[model samples]
Every structure is written in C-alpha cells, then in structure tokens.
Target: MPQGTLPTSLPADNTPKTYSGTKLVTYILAVGATGIVPPTTLTNVAAVAAAANTLTLRAAADTFIPSGSTLTFGTAQVITTADVTATAAGAAVAIQPAATPIAANATATYTNLLEVPVAEESNPTLTDQEETINVHGRITPIRVVNGKDMTATIRTLGGIDDPVVKRLITRGMSISPNNRERIIWLYPDGFALLATVNIGAPTRQAAAGNSQRVQVSANLSGGLFWANLNDPTPIWEAVNGN
Candidate 1:
C-alpha cells in the first residue's frame, strides 16, 4: 500500500547468475579439428643429438614437411617449426621445435597429427597424476593421462512439466552412451573451455513440500585434445575458445 512500484533487481555486468546458491552448467558442441587423422610419421635416418631438436632424414624432405607446420617427432615430441629447407641428404637444418626434444634413435619418426579437445564443464575436475617412489622420495617418471569427470544437478522451479525441463528429460533418456560430443563451459566473465564428452543417462527426483520442486542429475566424463604448441593452456576466451 505504501509503494506504487517495486524495485527491479538486475545482475551485475560480467557476473554469473546463481541459482539456489549454485552455478548452472553450460554445455555445447565442440568443433572438430581440421585433420581427421593424426599425421604420418616422418622417418629419421640418424640418431639425433641429446641437445638437438632438429631431425636429419635419409633424403631431401622439403616437399614432405612444409614451413610453419606442426609435427611430432619420435614419441612425445610435438613441435611446431618454421619452413623446412630442402638440403643435401644428412645435412643439419634447424628443427625449431616448440617443446622439449625427445631423444631419438635412427628409427625415430616425425608426425603431423594432433589429438582433439573432447570435454569441458561448469565444475570440472581435471587430474594428471604421477607415481612417486618412497625409496628415494622422488617422483617416478611414469605419468598418467589427464582425465575429467563431473556430475551436474539441474533443478526446475516451474514444475516438473516445464518445457525446458521436459526436453532435458527426453535427452537424458534417449542420448546414447557411445555418442561423443564437444562440450563448452561458458561463463559470464567471457572465460570458456572446450572438451569432448560422453554423456550418461540422467536421473530425476521429486520433493514433497508446500512448494513443488523437481531435480535432475547427469554425469559425464571424457578427455581433452590439444594441438596448439605455442600456448598449451586449456582456458581461453569464450569467443576464441568456442
């Protein structure tokens, strides 16, 4: 009776909206990398020096490897180098690899293939664990691949029959476990991440109280692939990452 109009609450610019004190998850399709398959391995004829990053082949490889192309040499040596020059067989040219060089024998090979980014989520846990030894109290050289998994809870205040909630309900029931899709987690602050995901069936629950409440839960897991040798960071701007 005292006020003629009510004040409207507006969210701050570049701020994320909170629901029930929890942030919502954003999911999307991931764009595929240009190369469908990994690059063919380039053969190495000689043993590369421990301090050297370049590779010497048995023949002129100027036509085989182009300039500004990213290639992987031996095992775990992914490098992006400048234009390669065609030189006499056994001539030493700069490899200019972006990452640490892997010690290679005569059988070492260089490849141009790359892994794709497979998944991203709102509350993601990425783990890259390594084994350590107690005898020397030192970290073991053995490494584990990075893995990610997260479960998201979705709630609807507009009753369980809400159109949007209904869509999710159908998706949870129909989506396949083998279907691999690209997912992107977007933030109001313009931060984003992209990854591949394998979705699981969703479960729904109902609460009994004065107000009608419904909740849906889903779990997903997958790995991420990277091709950028210059900067290998996963976090990126929303526009660029998307």
Candidate 2:
C-alpha cells in the first residue's frame, strides 16, 4: 500500500545476478468497464420476410378451357376441380375448367347437334317449326277490281263454281249485310295484297262524307258468315307436279 514498496506477495531480490536486466512494475486495478449498444429501428419497408416464395396454379382433367388460352402447367398437382355445368340457354350442357384443367372435348358447345363435325342426321327427325311444306294452285285471274256485288245473285249463272267460289257463296261473301262485296282496289304487282276490300273481308261502304278518302280494311272475321277464299292473285310461275 505504500508508494515506495511493491506488494508483500513479491519476494525481495538483492543480488545483481538474480534480477539483472528485467524489472517488474505494478499498476492500480480499476473496478468498472464500459460497452456500446447498437441502435435498432424498423425504418425500412423491405425489412419483412416475403409473403409467398413461389407462384402456382392447379390442374385437372375433363374440363372446358377458354378458347385460345393455354393451360399453363400440365400436372394435376395442387387442384383438380374440373366440373360440368349447363349453359345460360335452354337445355345446353358444358364443362367448365378449374384452375388449369384439361378438356377431352375441348371445343364442345351446348347445342342440339354434336360438337364434332359429322354427316347430317339420317334418322327421321322431328319437323322443325322453321321447316316449310309447299302446296300448288293455278291463278285463273290476275287481281282485277270488280264492282260491289251487294246482292250476289252471280253464282246461279254458272252452277259449276270453283271451290273458292263455293266457299264465297256459302260464306255469303257478297250479298250478306256485313259481308257484302265491294270493289277491291287491287295492287298492280298482282300476287300481293297491298290492300284487300270486301268479298274477302267486308267493310261498310264509305259514309258519304268519308267517300272521297281512301280506306284501308283490316280483315273481317267470319262470325256467322263463311270466310271467302283469299283473292286469286295470278302467280303465273308454277312448278310442275306442285
């Protein structure tokens, strides 16, 4: 503890040969030490770990794929949710793809006909509403305007009345009160009925005031009267064996 002497634990050496060149010196011991701590802050957006390591898609079979779209990967690895469903339209069926599913009938659509191109159906098919059947007749007279046969006593002149003529007579197409015949102003383009007047569909004779004005006639329903045949507009063109 004194300034001039070393600690008592050290042994004293008096001889020059014992400690000739080297000297031992002692220094005071300190009680405390200091350290530095680093600063920590969540200041960067890139500090968080990535949400997903990889991007992936699921695959399946027997499913519909969008046109011109590719099924990215082939294996049915993650998912296989291929499904079949109906179309928005009536009675149509379809398959929908789940994820990246493959389709056996890829081009198939919901329809009456097969999706694949094939020959026309040979079996006795039901008659479609769009289908039409044709019948034949001869036009004896082109559309000609005849005067009102108000009291049609005309049929007795020739007992051999045409079938249409017979219907007119039975229907009281001419002489009856509401069904009384009038002069039809025929359309020049013979076959069409731009406007039809009495005998076909009866109209009351124009009132004296309305006489000058042209009148368009809607068809007359045969109430008690028989309906006359439609006027004979001469369709000169006739198909053989029609």
* Top of the candidates by TM-score: 1
The sequence of per-residue lDDT tens digits that candidate 1 reaches over residues 102-141 is 4433333333322111111135444434444555776564
The deviation in Å at residue 136 for candidate 1 is: 4.4
Choose the strongest candidate by lDDT.
1
Model 1: lDDT of residue 52: 67
Error of model 2, residue 123, in angstroms: 50
TM-score of each: 0.34, 0.14
The residue pairs in collision within model 1 are 30-182, 39-113, 42-110, 67-83, 116-225, 117-225, 118-195, 118-196, 119-195, 119-196
Q: What lDDT does each candidate get? A: 0.41, 0.22
For model 1, the superposed segments whose C-alpha errors exceed 4 Å read: 1-25, 28-122, 129-132, 135-141, 146-160, 175-182, 208-242
Collision pairs in model 2: none
Query: Positional deviation of 111 in candidate 2, in angstroms?
Result: 33
